[model samples]
Target: MSYSEILSFVQFIHYFTIIIFLTFNITNVLSIYEVGVDYHAFGTNFTETAFLTQYHISNVRSIVLVQLQGIADRGANFVTLDIWFGSEPGKITDEHWLATFPMSAQETTNLNQYAADVASIQSKIDDHRLHLNIALFWLGIADYKIGNLTEGFGSDYLNASEFTARIEKTTDCIITAISNIRCSDGTLLVQTVYLEAEVMIGAKPNQDWFISTHYPRFLNQITVAGFTPAIYFLVDAREEYILDKDYIDPQYPALNGHRCMYWVYRSLNFLKIHQLPFPKRIDFSCYIDRNTSTYANLTYHILNDADAALSVLDAPKSYGIAETYYFIDDTQRKEFGQAFALEALSNPRLSHIRFWTTPDAGGKGIHIAYPFAIEDFLPPLKKISIN
Candidate 1:
């Protein structure tokens, strides 16, 4: 065909693809509803009234559960079941509590309870108005108590099969319960799985290496079971966010800065596999020494404060691995005016780097701020690596 014909064909294909994509997305938009919050350890404390009120203003339309109780009676439409694997009925002790893969008899009993919980929750969903989308078993509990994190999964720790079985059992329970519901063919239940296997943050090694190394192994299993992945990255930060004894775990971060900092490193590395949106842009100026006169001096400031620098440098993205750029006003740049400090922000190794000030600030010395940190979490950095 002629060159014009090829161009015309290409344009036609593009528009056709666009039309199909738009239609698919529109259908999804109309169907899917998300509600609920990250019910991490707040499992028992959650009340439908309190929970709904919290997100009512935000218009959240989906639910993500870390624990289950009398939610079914609460009139919830969509529920995301965070099927946890840990402990058994009766007096629970640390030695035998951690449920391993393949599941021991006691562990099986625990899973039975999970199934019962789902039935109860689903009964509520069935009784409530509207449809429901249930994400089965979001891996295990978002804490270190579930497994031997230091050694990682398998042998002495979690077995992929155990997690799979838990999910299977949970799904089976839902299916059976829904079938038994003489109360309706009214509630529409769409079954999907949202899997997550997160590492803890405060132990000696914190199982960081073990969890990271074994992450893909478990994640692949989840996918093979046909589950979608969800983020529990913030769970590591929560020990710091909620200060009460109930939420406070001695093995996790207790300060907001520490929590935010944990996410920075953990997320940066996790981004290598799964891309997520970057969180709101936290200002570098907040952590850096404000009085530093020049860009070179600012560089010294960063070099002097390595921990702070890493926390700022490795800030987590809001969504999966999208490119991000940070803007610095000329005034801030003047701090590093013609020096290595200025180069630090301009490092090509970083994702997004912009050097202009926004009009809203009216060009005042751009004071930097982070989302959670009221104060510095870590001691000043002693050594640094820009890479």
Candidate 2:
């Protein structure tokens, strides 16, 4: 019959098999802390085994990975087939390009293969090992080896209409491929798609084109038909993080790691700002330094601190939840306010701890953290005017 009909039939068979295979449980999938790190623990090259290892060490309920038509090609071809669950290991060979540019109905076979690939991935996530998030493509980054000036080169390098079309096709295929995936705990596992737009570390010509020119257009073009909006959020869209050395790739500013506090914190801030109106999640690629092996250790430490913070029941309540606070560490404390803030944040008893430094403190590496219990020990005070 038709390609869509064939895909539907294949999905029907897959669903039938799952119904026969898995025992239905009545428990609810509880709200899980979605702290996650991308599948970059294996250096420049990515592998499933390495992803599993990183997942375990991260102590997070979610793991992030990408399925490409090809990473280095113009059609944006890169696929993950080897470690997919419910399939023979290495049964479907990896492909560089799922479909060529100027796509046609003949590409239906490619679409079917892509759908199957996503189905396999969903199966693995349904095992409840960890939630899976797929980063569609690195927007704004260019690969010279990929396409021509007319086609606009690689993933983010494409012209507006071309990029949107490609993303629409890819997103549609992935969403259609994986149907409702229920975890053993009975929680529905909807795949999270990350619409990535970021600024890179070092300078490259036309890198900012996607960010400045295309991304705004993208916001309009992206459509969440089957998936929930809560299942998505922007990654590394803030400009300050891109320029900050502390949060960037050592070799290239664009590639970020766990050390890039802004990478996660910014998304968190966005969520807070937007109040997370829809289903949304973001995954971080953490690196302690520039080394790959340190990902697990670094992620563990951060999560451990977060876990500890969650246990606190009583912390001094402060006003101005949105207002900035300054932590003034006059104590020749070597670690200073940063250390002080870290200690307080890690304490389960304390939440809403934000720190800032005044011009005077900034000069001396000291900071002023506020909303502390000044009422308990001090007398009534009069307000002072700067003038």
Candidate 3:
């Protein structure tokens, strides 16, 4: 594309407060979730809800389970199911814009590109049949936001019980689905699946409730259920990355800055409770573009604090689920201010460097199919290498 075209495209994306184009060396690409048909196994039924509706989960999940079982029986050292959710759900973007320009390309579409991504991944997995590392299962329900964060920005008071319940429900669904996908040798098909969600900003005490109480309980619950899944949170700090200082209102306290330190400190420090071998893990994820100033600094603090927390307690090990969600093309990668930080990132806790939330996935705002936001090429970068 010519410079003028590229510039036009960049400005157009700015029109939507979104941009794309990420090229990276992927260690393990994340698979998209497709809601299959009614699923009934282990004497429980998986049904549709407001967030996720099943189209064909049974056959897909079963095929994936059986494939993983074959791999396990073959004595693979470990297994990782790449699907981030048990049931995939599409999100709505840009209400006010769509309210005006209905004919434009911004018409809201479901996760069409994400579905295609998994379909291809499934084909590749099935074609090999012997080596199965990735299979898709979805988990998402975002109704846990506080006031002004809820739908339509109404005065929805942040109820602590309701807040925890939403996240708890989503976590339970993920665990229930994976725990039931047992191999023929009585082993669970999946050892770990990485799932993502965000805890909307609200009262500090309410956020603390999720961090201290709910996190430990979640840890034990997954361990007891023999489910090891990484629950990751992707925070949205589009305008300014604010670090919460004494119950600030304008910033998110849930897993950001000092709150993230507290989360790491109180999460039982990734150590086994009740002598369980596998501790349930959750990942802290954030977006980093060249635009934000304090993001890289905050990230550095997060990693350092996590290390300090683990070291102070002398925890046996550290969590390897830390990731950065970003999409920058080669041109931007070389010139962007975050390029130095991307190369400088040497956090041992960091694992996956994902190029995430393209227009295909509806991104931060509503979008339809576009040229710049292709997922086939916009896979994640490896943690060790940004080039």
Candidate 4:
């Protein structure tokens, strides 16, 4: 029989086995609020388990942690698996790349090093009992070790056709990597692959076809491959509250005929130059051939306090502050923390609020010295005196 037939038969048998297993032993697979720190917490002094244990806030912290063996122990069960697939340097191939998994599919002479990198993550999680809900894959951030479609090389493609072929391979590699990295139960340790579907971190590519079509296709392939594609939206609502619009809220600066507010007239409601037609996107079912709604469910990451101001209730599925340290003092943190935690508790959907050691991020000194203030970044509200 052909490989395709064999694979299909194997998949059928696998499904049948699963059905038989479930038929005999049935239980709920519902996921709970995997609330905890990200991979950065491992080495950084941002949040230590002691903080949760030592400083007990209101009842809001009830679900924060009950006990702690480490960052991933007990109540703090969530952790991040930030892997670099370009570890193999230049061993690019359709089947396997030793640089990543190291003889991942073949007999390795260097058995000790084979997949030792990724294997270590699995070992750590198993030891500490962590649940990985995000893939902060530091793509294109490391050294110039690869020349493939992934990492920092994809956007270099001249056109959509070229980008399609290149990104499909990257997606294939990503799929393989996700499949390879599993927990002791033989399930995916890393959920929600951070498919940028836009320019990856530091991947400054020509926006021509990359954004227009290349990225759209990339995310589509990811969904079709039986993975729930995810992207992050770092939104700040402080400006919105002050100006009644966030930059991305189709109002600030203005797009699709949005009103640009310049310090709010301090009072006047900005006006849109033109009211554009609503754009319709492809349905979720079209990608994977399943019955679904026209609504878009997304996962969001709020890195700073500015990001936390937005209404996460809209993205009820998954949304939370990943790493927020802009609080001026302990008072600010306590006040803001309590309010944020309280709101998160009410939201049945879930809000990922991470509390690390508190020294590096929340303790000692934390300020918004990000080199550019929000107002400074805004386009100069030009004056033209049309009278």
Q: Considering every candidate listed, which one attains the maximal TM-score?
A: 4
Prediction 2 global C-alpha lDDT: 0.31
Candidate 1 local lDDT, residue 11: 100
Rank by TM-score (best first): 4, 3, 2, 1
Alpha carbon deviation, residue 354, candidate 1 (Å): 35
1 versus 3: better TM-score goes to: 3
lDDT of 1: 0.32
Model 1 collision count: 31
Q: Against the correct fold, how does model 4 do in TM-score?
A: 0.42
lDDT of 2 by residue, 196-279 (tens): 422231233443343333333333333333433222222232223322334443432223433333333333333334433222
Report the number of clashing residue pairs per model. 31, 24, 13, 6
**lDDT on C-alpha atoms for all candidate structures:** 0.32, 0.31, 0.34, 0.33
Q: How close is candidate 3 to the true structure, as a TM-score?
A: 0.41
* Whole-model lDDT, model 3: 0.34
Model 1, 220-248: lDDT tens per residue?
54344443333332222122221222332
Residue-level lDDT of model 3, residues 1-387, one tens digit each, is: 999999999989876553232221222122211001111121111121111122134543444344334332322223222322221123444221111111111111111221222222322222311211222222222222223334311123434554455446655555554455444455654444433233322322234334444555666666687755444443333323334434332322333344444434344333333232222333444444324555456555555545544455554334432333323444443232243234233332443233322232223543221122222222223212212
- Give lDDT: candidate 4, residue 77: 44
Error of 2 at 16 (Å): 50
Greater-TM-score candidate between 1 and 2: 2
Model 1 regions more than 4 Å off = 1-33, 37-75, 78-102, 109-204, 235-265, 271-387
